[model samples]
Target: MARVQHAKDVAAERLLSIPGVHTVGIGYKRRGGEVTADLAVIVFVDTKLPRADVPPDRMVPLEIRFFMDSSDREESVPTDVVEQARPVEYTHIPAGTLAGRARPVAGGRSIARAASGGGTLGGWVWDGLNDEVVLLTNNHVLGGAAGTDVFQPWGSTAATDHIADVVRTGTLDATIAAPVNAADVLEEIEGVGPAVFEITTATVGMPVEKSGAKTDHTTGWVEYVGLTGHYGSTNDFQVAPDPGMPNGRFAYYGDSGSLIVERTNPSGGSWKRVVGLLWGGNPELGNAKAHQVQDVFADLNLDTLCAGAFEEFLDNLFAPNFPEEPLKVTPIQLPEPVTMPLTTGPRVSLSGALLALQQAAGRPFARSRPLHRGMARDVEARLRLSRMGSDLVTAIHENRVGLARLVLDRQTRRALASAAAPFVEGVWTADELLGRQVTEEDLARFHRVARIAEDHRPELQPLLERVNRILGELPGRSFDDVLR
Candidate 1:
């Protein structure tokens, strides 16, 4: 027998003294402590259970503790209600375990061969990660062609391959569908899954529907958008339709990859714009949250709508090279939030970030300092190039090291920080510079910057309105979006 340590023993070591529980047995559920000299705490049980040790209470239960400290892995989620904005906590939360959606139509309608008992309802075309765009339909919906092998849910072993990877030119849509020839034969494999395809989200309320091999056609409202979630048992990724329109209608199972939309159902009105792809949902709340079919498309990279600079920057981050500095603008003028690849001379450890703030408050070397290799090529040169920028360089450089403690002297830092607009310390944030925060004057400066910002094109209107709203929401001239 091994010398089993109880949870109590682990806690004692971390505290450097005894913990809440004075004593514990071999197996008991309780707060954890460090064990095996690692950061993780060891789980324990109250009994060894040579046989099934029955509890006096007649109930055998297991204990699992969710670490509360990790906000990223929160056990609690947003409250399901109307009008409340979804809190930006977990960036990528997926909706549910969904396959896609399919419908049956005339034999001539489907991508499947007409002779294979054909009928086709509209399906969705979604992103499949690379150049591939997955076509979702019922296994029965799409008939076999003479050639090309299909992968079943698990593997091809005679279980009838339902999901077929799209190998045609470009993506097949309502206007165009993947064609099937006589040589195609869908092989079946044992122990697989429902035939599936991911549906990429279209516009804000693009209408869509599905006809599964089993259940023909079903409709629902577009809910939730831009979601990121994990598969049930695996870490496979999903980014669901992140936002949705009014009302709470959405997709359900057997409707996996169901084209989410404000579908132009013979019904009328702008409210009918289709959105969302059916992937999964919350069983606990019934139909409260519907996952996006686009998640699958995005996961698979199926949809090929906008793959210009806007698209490439997302997946293949380093695909494009930046020859110049990213644009700088006031928060009001900023287009969308961009994650520019920032390089500091050295790694920004916690202590280092704190140290730089103090140094900024004090004095820094007058000229450039060779901090580390990761510093931008022009960083030191820029410091040498401008006088105030040198000090701003040091302060900004410290902020690069996680410097967040100081009550920002917007005026003082602005004087030193900006290479373009170097002025005196009387002003700080837009609020300060405009003689107050986010005034009409601040909005004017925002427009000046927006006029020059290439990214701000097509974004000026909404951005301007949002800035006003945020300023109106501000309490006593406090600025929090800056912190964000």
Candidate 2:
């Protein structure tokens, strides 16, 4: 392999200078329309002309020579010429209908710099050092000085459509953009579902798939790895379209930055493991070129393809809403029976009255405490608060008091209802004992409840205070801290 690579390197520049030649790489040679096991310097050309029709100087050589320094010798390696009209970078003009605007943006959708043409979003990746999620795409799509605005659906001019900003670019034709809101991005590919966070190296003959802005989803097979194309781009792999694909093309223009993934089946389930980032291709020959995914990650210093914080957010979102069993309230036991005199004259036990009240309230009271606790920890609930708080904060921070008040009105009713359920239950229980004067045993039971409540106070207080402020019942400075 090294000998063949060295030979290709020696002959590539001279061969590429030939009139019809397009690219030079190493791959299995083909004879009589069938690929053979023999390795050769594969030359892609615009036309496969007969010797009589081509000039001697423009003719591709059958073999090339490379010097071996160790043995003080030179050796001849064979070459194979295949027809490819032209190689093209997959960007600029929109050619297909697979792209559209999406919210909570994901990969394989249309995206572009605010001032540039559109391309495919490769995927989402985590920049652990910055504690954020960023969008991955081709350099030509998102590359620029830091803070260059990016948008979805290619040419959207609305401020609300502005999604990310270019933060990093790589020599591998890769670029990453930090999203304006990390929570608005998902580590998923359109039509292909969630991608495996890890990447695998591309190998010859490996079957692969990619979802792109223009092509949507397509299958291909690795033709060659470690291939160098025009302009001296290294560490690239070539993909040949599946024979069943339309026009034998795996990718089209505007499909740049599409993530090439290998689909693997283990235990009867399929997973998409990333292999490369699509950049350029020869659509006529169905040969697409991409930088190895491993190289892309190394160049960008990325941790993983999926955001950890978003994973946590998802976990909180899909968790069960209610515990399997109802919350059992243990009655507050007193050391001795405390009799309370009723206005009717017959004496009743305070603990007995409390038990009777709880029974009267039935499942509604029994279910309330757990429901409140569950909602406090749920992501959907948190998102509600975050959304409301963000609206109010943005309004106030931007000096829009009228908007803030309107947001306050809408959020306050919901917040008060959510915040008051557990408190209402507590007050109702306390009201039952109010008719009888407070006693030593009653005071002891109250202290026990206080001690129990204190353990969970730290966790519950932030949520309560955030709700209180939204309802205009508590004075506070920032809703952001409480939401966090």
What stretches of model 2 exceed 4 Å from their correct place?
67-69, 72-75, 92-97, 128-131, 265-270, 306-484
Instruction: Write down the lDDT that model 2 would get.
Output: 0.65
**1-484, model 1: which lDDT tens digit per residue?**
0112222232323322221211112221123321122212222222323225544342222322233433455232111111122211111112222212212111101233223332222332322222212344333323223223333222122324332433332122221123122112111100111122112344322334433222234344332232222231111112222234112223223333233343352332212222333333442222322334343343334442222111221212211122223458765656778678876796454434654642343212111111222123223443444454354444433222111111012232232233213221333223333233444544444444333331323323443344445445544343422222
For model 2, how does the per-residue alpha-carbon lDDT over 190-249 read when each residue is reduced to its tens digit?
777665365778877889888888888889898877666633565688999998887677
Best by TM-score: 2
Question: lDDT per model, in order?
Answer: 0.28, 0.65
User: On a 0 to 100 scale, what is the lDDT of residue 127 in model 1?
Assistant: 29
TM-score of each: 0.25, 0.59
What number of clashing residue pairs does each candidate have, in the order they appear? 83, 0
